[model samples]
Structures are given as structure tokens and as C-alpha cells.
Target: MTATVQPTLDGTTPPAPVDYETWLAAVWPHFIAAAASGRTFTCYSIADTNQLPDPPNPRAHWGRLMHQLRDDGYTRPAGWTCSDRPTTRHSGVRTWKGTAAAQREAAA
Candidate 1:
């Protein structure tokens, strides 16, 4: 999913629309920007004179997307937080730790 461009059947048309953001989650950051959503899929070939491959063009926008995701990290599912880092405050760092723990224990 990192690559948005679909593999080509021949050498011209691309495949169905596959949202790159939703597709590549495993290699995403915790926070993504609105600008990242505007990117779309395109295709490129690896070989200089040989035919292009299907479903994974190295020259397509998808390739760039994957490069961006892999290099910078783009969180998936539109709003899914990046899995690599902790977004919320750590549990032990809370000032009211005892009270929070008591409340959680009582609720349980």
C-alpha cells in the first residue's frame, strides 16, 4: 500500500484507485498532515528498456508515497496515530497516579 500506483498490465493504463494512506499503515508516523492526503498514484518502470511490471511500479506516485512513508513515516487510516511512538502521557508520569489507579481499580 505504500505505493499508490498500480502495476500495469501492458504499458499504458493503471489499475483501480487504491488509497495509499489507508493502504500503508505499518510504516507510518503518528501525526500526518492534510497535505499528505492530496497525493495520488502514478507509475514508473525499473528497467530502462524492458517492460514494466504489474502492481508495483518503482516510478509511480505510489513509489514516492512509499518512499515518503518509509523515509518520514505517514500514519494510516486517515487518523490512526503512528504506532512507533507514544502519543499520550506515560501512566507513571501522572501527578495523580495513586488516585487514577484507585479509580481504575474501583471501576474494575
Candidate 2:
């Protein structure tokens, strides 16, 4: 069945979604770079800054990515802050900070 697309909360059209694995691979490097920067950031901020493709299931995929990064020792939950995503209307969001491993990865 075809999935219905919904307009973002800001009334803008969302980017067309891509295959889950392909999208993940494409965005992983950018996210690693963001983590290595050693600055607190939100998932959307990294994705927006990198112009990464949207995942097939945004809600699930984004969270999954963050958790995977944490599990992989690249990032940690830093804190909470207002989201900068245009579609989110400044709602509260979780922030992440890079770990030493991420910094080392970037250097290598």
C-alpha cells in the first residue's frame, strides 16, 4: 500500500523519503563528522546541515540512528534543548555530544 505523506507542522512539504539502508549509509558520515566536532547537536541539526536524505520512516529512523551512534561509542546524550528543525516548531529535543572515540575516528 502507498503511504500517505503529511505536510510538516510548518506547512512545508517534507523531502521525499529514501530506502532505509541507503539513507543510513549516506548520512552516517555526515553524522560522524558532526559528532567529531565535539559540539552538542540535535539529529535534525546534523541532517539539515548536511542536506541528508530523509529516511523511509523518519520518527523511527532518526531515533534508531542516534541510539546506534551511542551504542557505537561515538556519541552520548548531552542534554535537552529546543529543536531547530523548521518542521518541529522549536519543540524540545534531545542533544548529543561526541565521545573521545568519535574524535579519534575523525583524526584517523
Candidate 3:
């Protein structure tokens, strides 16, 4: 069964949820570029802070994007954690680094 997406704060219907793979395709280039450049950034930064265009439902979209990145072999460095600020999603927000394979794919 499909899940219903709740409306945004302004009462407009939220964008339909895209499957992880589909969403990943749209955003992986950004991740791969960051990774290739040896940057470490948080999903929270990309989502909540307007790093990318703020999706209609950033919390769900970025949360899943980060999860799928890990599953797809993106690496996270040691001793890093997400912001501890109260409004943040969670402390588990991981810092991701790019992999050679991802870089190649992005460059293609």
C-alpha cells in the first residue's frame, strides 16, 4: 500500500514521494561532486539549510537519501556527528565522504 504524504505547513499538498532510487538519481551527482572534492557534509545541512533546493518534504526526502547513500557504499569518516542543536533531526546525522566509484559515475 502507498503512504499518504501530509500537507506542508502552508496547507498545500506535499510532493509525491519518490522511491529512493529515483530520488538518488536526481541528487547523487551533488553527493558525488562533494565526495570527489573531499568534502564532508551532513544530510541535515543539505536538507534543512537550503544546500539543495528545499524539497517539498525535506525531512522525509533527505532522511531517506542519506540512508540510501550509506547502503550504496558511500563512506562516513570517524569521530563525526551531526549538530547537537535542539531543532536538529537527530544526533545520528552522519558525515559522508565520496568514493572513487561514485566519483566516476558522477563524471560520466
Candidate 4:
């Protein structure tokens, strides 16, 4: 059976959910750019800054994306800070900074 997207109260259909790999491919470059800035950042901050599309499963996939980036030598944990996401009520979140590899990628 095919699943249908329901229209919201405003009568607009929501965007189709993107699979993890597709969403990651779309947003990776933006994340890399943010990482290359060499400033600490939260996942939400980068998403908001770049207006990235939400992942299919935000609660899990977002963290997965960060871990993948770290594993790829693009970013590293810098410290913890309160999230700037309006809906997050300023909860403590881990922050990341660009690694040397990210700088090299940016320079290339």
C-alpha cells in the first residue's frame, strides 16, 4: 500500500520525509561549511543557519549525522553549551569544532 501525505490545517501538504542518506547528502556540504568556520556549533545551529531540511528521524538521525562527521575526521567535540533552538528551552547540548581535515577540505 502507498502512504499518502495528509494536508495540514492550512490546506498545504507537508513535504515528503527524506530518508537518512538522502537528507545527509543534501545537508553535508552545509555542515562542512559550518565546520570549516572553526567555531563551536551545535547541530541545530548549523541546520538553522543553512536552512537544512529535517531528517526523517530527527531525534536519532541528527546525532547520527554528528557522529558520522566526527568519524569522517571533519569535526570533533568542543564542549557543551545551551542550545539556541527556540523550541529546546536552552537545554545543554554538545558543541563541535572543525578538525584540521575539515579545514583542508574547505581549502580544497
Per-model TM-score, in order, reads 0.19, 0.80, 0.51, 0.88
Worst 10 residues of 2 by lDDT: 15-24
- In model 2, the number of clashes is 0
Best-performing candidate as measured by lDDT? 4
lDDT of 4 by residue, 35-61 (tens): 898888999988998888889998899
lDDT of each: 0.32, 0.90, 0.63, 0.91
Higher-ranked by TM-score: 3 or 4: 4
Task: Give the per-residue lDDT of model 2 (tens digit) for 26-106.
Answer: 999988988999999999988887787778888799999999999999999999999988888999999999998899988
Better of 2 and 4 by TM-score: 4
Segments in model 1 whose C-alpha atoms lie over 4 Å from true places: 1-16, 26-59, 73-108
Pick out the ten consecutive residues of candidate 3 with the lowest summed lDDT.
47-56
Q: Residue 7 CA error for candidate 1 (Å)?
A: 20
List residue ranges in candidate 2 displaced over 4 A. Answer: 1-17
Q: Per-residue lDDT of 1-108 in model 3, one digit per residue for the tens?
A: 987788889999966656656666777667656666556676655544434554446667666666667677764543468575467665665677766666676677
Candidate order, TM-score descending: 4, 2, 3, 1
Ranking by lDDT: 4, 2, 3, 1
Model 3 regions lying over 4 Å from their true place: 1-25, 48-50, 55-57, 82-86, 89-92, 103-108
In TM-score terms, which candidate is top?
4
Clashing pairs in 4: none
The Cα RMSD of model 4 versus the native structure comes to 1.6
